[model samples]
Target: MPVWLIWFIAALGLAGAEALTGDLFLLMLSGGALAAVGSNLIFDNYVIDGVVFLVVSLLLLVLVRPALRKRFNSGPALPDRAKALEGKNALVLDRVARHEGQVRLDGEVWTARPYNDDDVYEPGDHVAVVHIDGATAVVAKVV
Candidate 1:
């Protein structure tokens, strides 16, 4: 039938396909097709409608898609697991020396060591996790 009608149908099809992928690309093409429908209505020329479609689609893909994707994808930033434990109190489960020890942190047992090689903590003493080194917790006496 009319060129505008064909473009309108293509736009509808592209928008429907966009639901399956959820990537916004086909939705951008659908936007272009709608622009083509408008251009065809105004000029009734196939060449002008095609050009309008190309330009609008490329503009949406390059300019709008990234901002939309970023907005959709971004959320609250969470702290790293190791970093979250720093400065938290722990109970010394065994004598904590520079070389080796054990502590209860957040209800879980963790391998621990004193932050200072010269420092030592007896079992039942309170300590704070200074930092994590791999699976081991580097700690300091709480007081």
Candidate 2:
């Protein structure tokens, strides 16, 4: 029945919802609810407590949430399988031509072709994978 108790309960509920959603929005609301509890302690006015909650929540949503989301999302990039193979060195296993060839890439044999139609790779040549087209790796002679 107490205003502070109501605010505290709302804060706890918002925090639990934040846990489930994993987004920063509900967490900001929970911070606002805690601020409302503080306002209730100081002013004992419902209007002041509600105003404090709204202002604090909006400030957090507008300012802190974006920065937190950016920090959370902008971590180091992780490459997928195709991107991971790019620029990796492979050993030519058979005579490679513009349209046809084979290479051993990372201990596994992969179908390969010259990155450029004019290039030719002899067996025992080292090449760098340039890109993947379906199951084939387009490779260029390593230097």
Candidate 3:
């Protein structure tokens, strides 16, 4: 049993663990184990190989891991449900005037009112959701 052979086995085991975990942490440890295999070739000493493995693993965890995680985690920030309805298209299910109306948004009926005081939306008209005011949707006629 050579020291390099032991490190190679450890690297293979750690790589299998990485596949199970799906996190890059174990993969970084596997990289360190591979480094130890290289160190064993140069120094041919188990103690120095173990030291190199520990140092390389820690460096990857502290320095490289955060950057990788941040890059992978970057995505669109989702707005809350209430805010998400803003600017959505809706259909006027009932006559819409400044005082009262009804519209269908996302297949759900919602209380609606014209965005402008004099504006009116007839049934079958397409409208844009301006904002939600309490239980009501402020909407504007598409045309």
Candidate 1: clashing pairs of residues: none
Q: Estimate the Cα RMSD of every predicted model relative to the unseen true structure.
A: 4.4, 3.6, 6.1
Ranking by TM-score: 2, 3, 1
Spell out the clash pairs found in candidate 3: none
Output candidate 1 Cα RMSD: 4.4
Among these predictions, the greatest TM-score belongs to: 2
lDDT of 2 by residue, 55-134 (tens): 99999999999999999999998868888899999999988897788999989899999989999999999999999889
Ranking by lDDT: 1, 2, 3
Clashes of each: 0, 0, 0
Q: Which stretches of candidate 2 lie over 4 Å from their true place?
A: 77-84, 92-102, 111-127, 133-136, 140-143
Better of 1 and 2 by lDDT: 1
* Model 3: worst 10 consecutive residues (lDDT sum): 73-82
The TM-score values for the models, in the order shown, are 0.58, 0.70, 0.60
Cα deviation of 123, candidate 1, in Å: 4.9
Pairs of residues clashing in candidate 2: none
